[model samples]
Target chain A: MSRSTRIMMSVIYWAFVVYVFVPLILMIMMGFKDSKFIGFPIKSWTFDWYLAVFSDTEVLTVFGYSTAIALLSTVVSLFVGTWIAVLLADRKFFGRAVMFGLMVLPALVPGIISAIAFRIYARVLGIEPGMFAIIWSHAVHNVPFVCLVVMARLSTLPKSQREAAQDLGADPLVTFVRITLPYLRPALIGASVFCMLLSFDDFVRSFFLGGYQPTLPVLIFAKLRSGMSPEINAISTVVLILTAFLGIWAERSMRRMKKET
Target chain B: MTSDAPTQGAAAGTAAAAGPRSLWSSLARSQPYQKFVDVLFASQRRSFLILLLPPIIWVLSQHLGPIVQMVSVSFTDAYPRPPGQEAKFTFDNYLLFFREPVYMMPFMRTLIYAVVLTFTTLIIVYPVAYFLARHVKRENRMALLLLLLIPFWVGEIVRTFAIMILLGNTGAVNLILKSLGLIDRPIPFMYTGFSVSVGIIYLTALYMLMPLYSALEKIPASYTEAAADLGAGAWTRFRRVTLPLTYEGIGSGATLVFLISTGYYGTPVLLGGPNTTVFAETIAGFFHVAGDKWPTGAAFACIMFLASLALTGAFLSGMNRLSKGGRK
Candidate 1:
């Protein structure tokens, strides 16, 4: 590239980066503001907001509840998704395309539409709106992601490994448990973390399907509707830090696993 | 009779001699159970069934089931029907959307915004994606991409709140502008179409970037170099070589951004003014009301869903044709 073009590209790239970070930096800064109102010209900075978030029992309870929901939904999605991935990864089967389409349909449907659908469907099934309902919706939504990730990993598995296991007189179940599952460990871990984040971050479904209690995202939305506050900022910053750490770790570990193999 | 008696006698003797421990072991090692296990594992079809059944049931009952229910509900007169009230199937629920311009306005506005913002996001993100994919060192690309991805890890509400803080009346934008002598007063940036668009683009830009970057990254450097050597200018080389190769990426990213923008409820609700309401907020409005209005909401949602899917379908096919034509 020419020098002027190179310079222009650098400028554009940096400008975009600045655009991406400004809001986030502002968010983090607002968390430390002494005032309740969210705006510029910070008169004083304090950790009182963060301290308040840590001390608030309601917030702490919501945090634990959301974590439990994420964990439960992730486990369910991983189990079903890994099963589907294994099934699809096998040599071409009847209705494979149709099944794969059905499997991925949840991911394609808009969040609001699906959230509403789940709400209506839960009523039909006589499933009350609560933790189980939210987890069910989340798991269904997350299955497509888990299945796709696991399938990607499964595609890289060599056929020889399974064949060798079978030749050694291992049953299909044993071969799967001993040979295939181990190979899928990295993908499972990655998908689990991703699913946890997705389920935790989910707001629309949790909002519609929830009864009285709220997920973290729903809580933030409630607080936002009441109006923006430094408390919301502080809570958001805490979530941001956690998810960022988890995301980076998952990425690094996934890359390392790939390298090691 | 003699052979049966001797075997029976031995069984009784062993059972009596060995007591409960031997009896349990013998039962476990019995021929019938062993045969059952052998038969179960002997057939590939059986194993396949075992593996496929759970997912099939889940997809049918959980994934497709709710959508089917929504479709059914959309056709009915009312949902969660009042006591002793029968659900009358009618086309009226869907007719409500066409009959009232109130609903139609936001629906149309949503499609327009989605299309425009998708294109805008493409334009804004394409250069950044290209820069990262081609200009940056390979060793540094992943790190930079991760940095961009951090903001997206937080949920929609948090990110929208970020935008609010940035563009509120006394926000950073106004303060900066004032200090720089750009304006004497705050521009009322919050709760405007401009803010909503900005927020949507910020939220969905990562979706656009990933595909574009991957597409750009896969292009061999030699192709562009060879085009240049053939006396093609920069624009021509890029148009002829790079753009065609990344058409798939562009299609995917555009589709994702468009669909996401159309369905976004939180950002638009948070940032948009009364004049800037999107279809999702309108659809949500129905559910927020009495249960009798749910069917109307369902119908509206179905319309939006079908329209968005159809538009993206057409766009993708057109993109495919364009890329093919470019090759010829």
Candidate 2:
């Protein structure tokens, strides 16, 4: 940690940051550009493209589809993952490590592999490969993630509190509802938000399960493959803004937790 | 979405229970109902089952099920067979895959792509993660990590498009190169192995960096401080103290990047040309786009599956050996 080395590293870090941010800036910039093809150094800025982005029925419908998928998956994960976390935290069992490994396989496995598996599984189950399959596919992925978050939050609360509640004549259900659920509120909210975004932004599984309708990412992918258009840039910019806001909110909430603790 | 340590359910009986489950509260407190009381009071067994089953089924369905089916489908013929002609389940497709020679080049090139991309990403990311975890201000560490995560937040398809825009003939990169007189014309940057590798390294650097950063951050500063106090230089400290501590994380990170990169369809398809497509894209094409030949596509996928499984197994063992060595 010599001063010279530190300065050099800082310079390098800045370069990396610029490399990451520049493209995003360009995307947003192109969204506002009035040009035949997207290029650097904008000439005439206009909202016509952004207007087109919103007005297009296909985009709007896909946007709705994406939102619905995200929302449904998040809700499912919150409830099911909470129960799973509760079960794990409450018991001593054989094969604990193995069970835990299985829990996390979806997160580590590539999306393409999961998508392939889902496609086959849906066919076998006679489930139509459509929006339901897409949402369920996302839920399978999101549950583990949401459970991990909720479980972490649950771990922070002292065991003594819940044990004491039970000892004081509170039933197990009562103890869970009154003592446990309240403490997990923040985590529930955060994990839900995380799940929602994971579903909304996903493209891989959606691509496999897209029967008659496309999700937002699928729409963007199709549009990009067809031809480079500024409208897709507009959509990307919008998604980027939403993601940035989510990131900030998450961090701020985490900081608030640290302060309270 | 990827975490190894999660809180268990034993704690949740105390955590999630609210009021009693039934009207037997008074009876539940009585000595006669002590068994139910003990079960309710001791939230161990039920919690374990509840926490484990759903995700197990979910993952099995999503990860293992298709793979099994894919393996089954690959053994059959590609052409339309009669209703009962698909029974023998031979290894003909796999044998054909080897004998065809069409898949040979792409398969070999994919190996090179994974190795080159893994090395390139590791080379770039190690220093970046090291600096962020060690040298940055405490407040800035999280912000910097957030920056690392931003590109991932934007879907890969969009990022690919962005790369195309930058590297295409009339794109910003070429425009800059032309204006600088660095090149006579815009080289084929958009649909080549070069761009494919670059795009992959960009896409996966974060996954590799996060684990490495976590490992680095967990290493006690005191160890390195002790090294420096003993007159060891920075490079010596990095090699002796920092590197050893991060062996497990490095192994996990490298395995992740390598395995995913091998089966990649997005980067290769978007950035690579007809000559440079990867195995996954070919498999996908045969199934969905080319002619709906699921059997051949499944065959291709099975080859990739086995290859990836072998690679992951080797990585796991190698990492274990390294971790053992580092422990000394």
TM agreement with the true structure for every prediction: 0.93, 0.87
B199 Cα displacement, candidate 2 (Å): 1.6
Note the Cα lDDT for every prediction shown.
0.90, 0.76
Best by lDDT: 1
Which residue pairs show collisions in model 1? none
Clash counts for all predictions: 0, 29
| TM-score, cand. 2 vs. native | 0.87
- The lDDT of model 2 is 0.76
Q: Model 1: which docking level applies?
A: medium
Error of 2 at A80 (Å): 3.0
Shift of residue A56 alpha carbon in model 1, Å: 0.3
The Cα error of candidate 1 at residue A239, in Å, is 0.6
The number of the candidate with the highest TM-score is 1
Model 1 regions lying over 4 Å from their true place:
A258-261, B1-39
lDDT of 2 by residue, B1-328 (tens): 1244345654555344534544544455567567765674466666445446775675566546666766776676643345566455667777878898888788778777887788788888888888998998788887778776767766677777677677777777777888899999777787888888877877778779889998988988899999999999989998888998898888888888987787556667778899887877766777586323666777776677677768778877987987788778
